[model samples]
Target: MAWWMSSSRSEKGRFLFFVLPSLICWHIWKARNKAYYEGVQMRLGRICHDILIDMKGVVEVQFNQRLGVQTFLQLYEGTAHPPPCYSVQLVGWRVTEEGTLTLNTDGCSKGNPGVSGGGGILRDSLGLPLFVFSTYFGETSSLRAEVLALATRLRLCM
Candidate 1:
């Protein structure tokens, strides 16, 4: 793993360096549970195919496109055709009305009922940050975390 991280020479290689290990571990854990609980036999080929499918799903979600599963497999096998070009969009904060501030908040969870957290920043009309906060919400759904984040930020306004 150390060698692989050190040898990654491209941005794509670096991105995969961080993503592949955890993804492989997750699949292996799922296979272990299925075998132990359901008496299902595990096959190396099946696991490999699953990993490819999972990676493809991730890429499709990120690129917001429905690409074929073989696209990701061919990438690792050194036989992939070039992917379609993606356009970049510029994003900026819209200035708030005078005398008012903007609060941007975000929240996330590890699993549906897993550990969660919420955070927010209070920014002025000119986009300067006035306050920032983050809090842990032991365990909750993603929707709950988001609601909690918004509520917490709203509390600050009140």
Candidate 2:
């Protein structure tokens, strides 16, 4: 049987292992294209540096470690940002008759067509989270992910 067919590894681990080669190849291909098209030739040393920086950022975020929010912001701002937008935003708000207010905040991957994740939080009158969650969907087109997220959220709300 194929290694992937075995249940020895968790789904997440399997997914990571399965996609690792493709991800590496994708980066190499992209770097080559950048060198050829953008005239931004990067030596292997520079490429390794860039990859290290990227991996650090990913580890910080994944582990929910505050290595410093500013570091993340600087690394992700504008043109320096990676595949996903890192902006925080408000989604909805409501005022209750009991003199209370609520806010719904969400962060979405606008690049659904690309590999992305989506997350949201619903806060009560005190800004305390009633619920919060995030999901990652692998390689897809942005438009397709957008529509799918919308449809999924609508279903969740309903």
Which candidate number has the best lDDT?
1
> How well does each candidate superpose onto the true structure, as a TM-score?
0.44, 0.31
Cα lDDT of model 1 by residue, 15-101, tens digit: 555677888998898998999999998877788778888876765676576754374445453322233569999979888788788
* Most accurate candidate by TM-score: 1
Show the lowest summed lDDT stretch of 10 residues, model 1: 75-84
Prediction 2 TM-score vs. true: 0.31
RMSD values for the candidates in order, in angstroms, are 15.8, 18.7
What's the C-alpha lDDT at position 115 in model 2?
A: 75
Stretches > 4 Å off in candidate 2: 1-112
* lDDT for predicted candidate 1 compared with the true structure: 0.76
* Every candidate's lDDT: 0.76, 0.53
Q: Which ranges of candidate 1 are over 4 A from the true structure?
A: 1-90
> Candidate 2's residue-wise lDDT over 1-88, tens digit each?
2333445554333543455456457667778999999998857766555554654455456546544423323433321212343798
